[model samples]
Each structure stands twice: as C-alpha cells, then as structure tokens.
Target: MPESPGLDELRVLAHPVRLRILSLLTGAAMSAAEAARELGETQANVSYHLRRLHEAGLLHVVEEVRIRGGLAKRYRHDPESGSRFMSTDPREGQLLLATMAEELKRRSEFRVQGKGGLTADAEMWVDRETWAKALAHAHELSELLHRAAKPPRTRGTIPVSTTVAMFEMRRP
Candidate 1:
C-alpha cells in the first residue's frame, strides 16, 4: 500500500485548483498546458500546482512529447495507488475538508436537474462490521467511477460529479 500523505502533502492538496487538476488527470494523461486549457486556468498557475503535486508523489509523469522544440511531460494519477489521509491532525483535516467544501459548492453550481442523481448525508452510529462493509462498498463505487471516467467533453459521454467523504467519528 502507498504511504499516507503527511502534513505538507496534505497542504499541497488543500487547494481547490489542485484538487480539480487531480480529478482531470485521473481521467487522462495531460501536460500542464492542456490541463490549464481544459480547466480554464492560466498555464503558469496550473504548472506550479502540477509541480507541487508531482513532488508530493500524488502524480506520475507518464509521457513526454516534443512541443515547439521543448519536451512537455504529461502527468497522470493512479486511483488504485491513492492512500487515504489517515492523519490525526485536526487542523490538517479541517483544511482538507474546507477545500472539499469549496469544490462541492462550485460543482453544485453546474448540477443539471431532471436527471438521475443522489444526495445523501448521515451522522449516525453503526456496528463495527456494518461500518467496515459500508466503507468497502463506497471504495468500490469510487473506483468504478474513476475507472469509467472519460476525458472532459468526450463525445457521447455525460459529465457527472461525485464527491465522497467518509470517516468514523469519535464518541462525545
């Protein structure tokens, strides 16, 4: 299994732009310029975040292509190698959660109605076995979605948003 990301790595992932970049790369390998164009961000800004994510071991350079006499490296993310953030640091968790909240809100703005969707929220107690089963099932579904992901604007594909954050809480 891959090592869990540390505080600094978590901080690198705590940016909304970086999160979007990660999601984009999961679907296809892309150079920084391509990702920037797809995400509607400046190339310089996306390049910087790509460097940070690559340094933190969250992204891998999968290919290099000659572009205007320079080699542009394409990066990709492997969902199977992704490690769950298991840090006990409250502030770090809060920072990541805040970033996720921002991303969720941004995605909500583009939500299409009248189509099939799911919205679920829960804060309840469950048996240990039940919790374990639920977590495993969620992981399976997440992997399915990632595997099925197509590049942005692919023909005959519908864009969808799936955000999942599951964790066990301590008793008060």
Candidate 2:
C-alpha cells in the first residue's frame, strides 16, 4: 500500500487553496487555467498553489497540450499518495484535522445543495465484538466502492462525493 502523507506534506497542504486544488485534481486531470476556472480564481493564483502541491509530491503531470502556440500542462493527483496524516505533536495533529474537516464540510455542504448525495451519521452503542464486526463490514464496503469508483469510463458515468467514518463517540 502507498504510504501516508508525512509532516512536511501535511505542512505544505495546510493551506486551504492547496487542499481545494487537490480535490479538483482528484476527479480529473486539469491545467492550472482549468482549475482557476473551476475555483473562480486567477490562473496565476491557482498556478502558485498548484506549484506548491506538485512540490509536495501530491500531484504529477499526466499530459501536456499545445494551446494557442503555448504548452498547457495538465496535472493529476496521485490517487495512492498519502490519504491520511498523523503527528506525534498534538497541536500539529489537531491543526491537520481541523484543515481536513473544513475541506470535508465544504464538500459535503456543496453535495447537500446539489440535492442528490447522502449525508447521514448515526450514534450507537455496541459490544466489542459487535463493534469489530461492524468496522470489518464497513471496510469491506469501502474497498468495494473504491474499486468501482472511477471518473466515468462511459457516457452514463455519474460524479459522486462520498465520505464514511465510524468511531466511538467520546463527547455528546
């Protein structure tokens, strides 16, 4: 399996722009200009963040196209590159989680607005064995979805955003 993001990568990605850019790149390869259009920012501003992401090794060039006599570089996020991050320093870890949570909330809110995605969570009590069994099942479902989820190989492909988490609630 691919290794998770380290401290340096986490530090670099702490910027909100980088995280947003990474999300756009995840579903498809795009040029800086294309990403700017998606984010409604200047191409130069998007390019700056894209450079930072590439430097952090989270993105890579997949193709280049000649446009208006200039070369446009398209970059794609490494699907296997660091999906998680943790730090021995508590503050740093909290910061990482905070940033990640903000991005996730932003995405979820957009999906909610679109009116076709799922947004639900449940709280439950269970025995150790029951919890373990539920977790195993969740993992299995996630693996199945990951294998099937791709950027539409056919014309009828649908774009979807999904997030799943299950853990013991420690707070009310």
Query: Which prediction has the highest lDDT against the true structure?
Result: 1
lDDT of 2 by residue, 1-172 (tens): 4455566667876777787777668767889998998888899999988888888778899999999999999998864554544344555666666777777877665563645656676887778899999888877876666555444343676556655556565556
lDDT of 1 by residue, 1-172 (tens): 5455678768987999998998999999999999999999999999999999888778999999999999999999877644765577888888898999999999999999989899999999999999999999999999899999888989998878888888889899
* Whole-model Cα lDDT of every candidate shown, in order: 0.89, 0.72
Task: Output the TM-score of candidate 2.
Answer: 0.67
Point out where model 1 deviates above 4 Å. 1-5
Candidate 2: which pairs clash?
Answer: none
Clash pairs detected, candidate 1? none
Residue 59 of model 1: what lDDT?
92
Candidate 1: RMSD to truth: 1.6
Estimated TM-score for each candidate: 0.94, 0.67
